[model samples]
Target: MDMEGEERIAAPRAVVWQALNDADILRQCIPGCQSLEWTSPTELAAAVKLKIGPVSASFSGAVTLSDVVAPESYTITGEGKGGIAGFAKGGAQVTLLDEGPETLLRYTAQAQVGGKLAQLGSRLIGSSSQKLATQFFADFNKAVVARAEQSVQS
Candidate 1:
């Protein structure tokens, strides 16, 4: 499946980029993310629980960021396993654009699944992915905006 979207954050590109790399901020922004830990400068381990239609599973995953252009763009690749439920692997390319005092965040992602999850059909998978992606970006935007406001207040 493939997904893409863009969001405008009320912060500069550097601020948004910093928040994106912060594990604490990401934990608050990612939907269903139970925990996120940095294993290295460009690698992280995460646990998330998700429900798709009638299927529910807990997934453990590792994400790696590469091809980075500081405060501008990067590629994120990840793979997750949910035991009997299934496994998924995906990659996303993210770009940041300066919009005056705001930053425009855009991303395109592709994923593949196998096992029971794959049996669920494309329509279900596609819709579920879209919903989850939307939720994640919304949460991320809120977090970034809130932090920016707090910083300004302080």
Candidate 2:
């Protein structure tokens, strides 16, 4: 599946970029994320539980960031195994644009699944993916905005 979206965050590009890289914030923002930890400067290990259709599974994955350009853009790739449930692999190109006082965050992603997940039909998988992606970004935006507000008050 393929997806794209953009969000306007009420913070500077640098602040938005920082939040994007913060494992703690990501763990909080990502729906169903059980844990997210940085294994290296450009890599993260994560565990997540998800329910798609009537199937529920826990996935463990490693995410790698490449072609990084600091506060500007990067490509993130991840692969996860869900035992008999299936496996998922995907990549996204994310860009942060400075929009004066706010930041415009854009992303384009592609994903594929195999095993039981692939058998679930593309429509189910696509809609589920979109919902998960939307939830993550919405939560992330709220967290970032709240953090920015707190920093200003500090």
Candidate 3:
């Protein structure tokens, strides 16, 4: 499956970039994320529980950041195993653009699933993936704005 979208966050590019790299903020923003910890400057380990249609499973994976250009753009790739429920792998090219007092974040993503997840049908998997991605970005936008506000207050 493939997906792309953009969001305008109410913070500067620098602040938005900081939030994007913060594991704690990402853990809170990602739907069903149980844990997200950085293993290296450009690598992270994560576990997420998700349910699509009637199937549910916990996926553990390694996320890697590459083609990085500091606070401007990067490519994020990940692969997760979910026991019998199957496996999922995907990658996204993320870009951040300055928009006056805010930041415009854009992403292009591609994903694939195998085993039971693939058995669920493409329509189901695609919709579920879209929903998850939408939720993640919305939550991330809110978190970044709130964090920016908190920092100003401090």
Candidate 4:
């Protein structure tokens, strides 16, 4: 499956870039993220719980950041296993565009599933992925803007 979208954050590119690189902010923003630990500067270990249709599973994965250009763009790739549920692997290219007072965050991603997850039908899995990605960015945007507001006030 393939997915792509853009989000406009009410913060400058610098602030948004900081948020994107911060693991704590990502853990808070990602849906069902149990934990995310930085194993290296550009590598992270992740645990995520996902419920698609009637199946619920916890996935353990590794995420790597590559092709990085600070405060601009990077490519991220991850693969996870969910025991009996199956496995998923995907990669995304993320770009941050400076839009004056706001930042335009765009991503293009491709994913593949195998075993039980692949058995759940393409539509169901695709929609679930789309929903999760949407929620993550929305929550992230809110968090980033809220911190920006707090800084301005203080």
| Cα RMSD, model 3 | 0.5
Cα error, residue 67 of model 1, in Å, equals: 0.6
Candidate 2 residue-wise lDDT, 60-98, digit = tens: 999999999997999999999999999989888999998
Q: Which ten residues in a row have the lowest lDDT in candidate 2?
A: 129-138
Please report the candidate that would top TM-score against the real structure: 3
After TM-score superposition, what is the CA distance of residue 136 in candidate 2 from its true location, in Å? 0.8
List TM-scores for all candidates, in order: 0.97, 0.98, 0.99, 0.97
Colliding pairs, model 1: none
Write down the lDDT of every candidate, Cα atoms only. Answer: 0.91, 0.93, 0.96, 0.93
lDDT tens per residue, model 1, 20-129: 89999989877789999999999999998888888898999999999999989999898999999999788889999999999999999898888889999999998888
Candidate 2 lDDT at 101 equals: 100
Candidate 1 deviant stretches above 4 angstroms: none
What local lDDT score does residue 36 receive in model 1, on the 0 to 100 scale?
Answer: 94
Count clashes in each candidate, considering only residues at least 3 apart in sequence or on different chains.
0, 0, 0, 0
Find the candidate with the highest lDDT and give its number: 3
Query: Any idea what lDDT model 4 has?
Result: 0.93
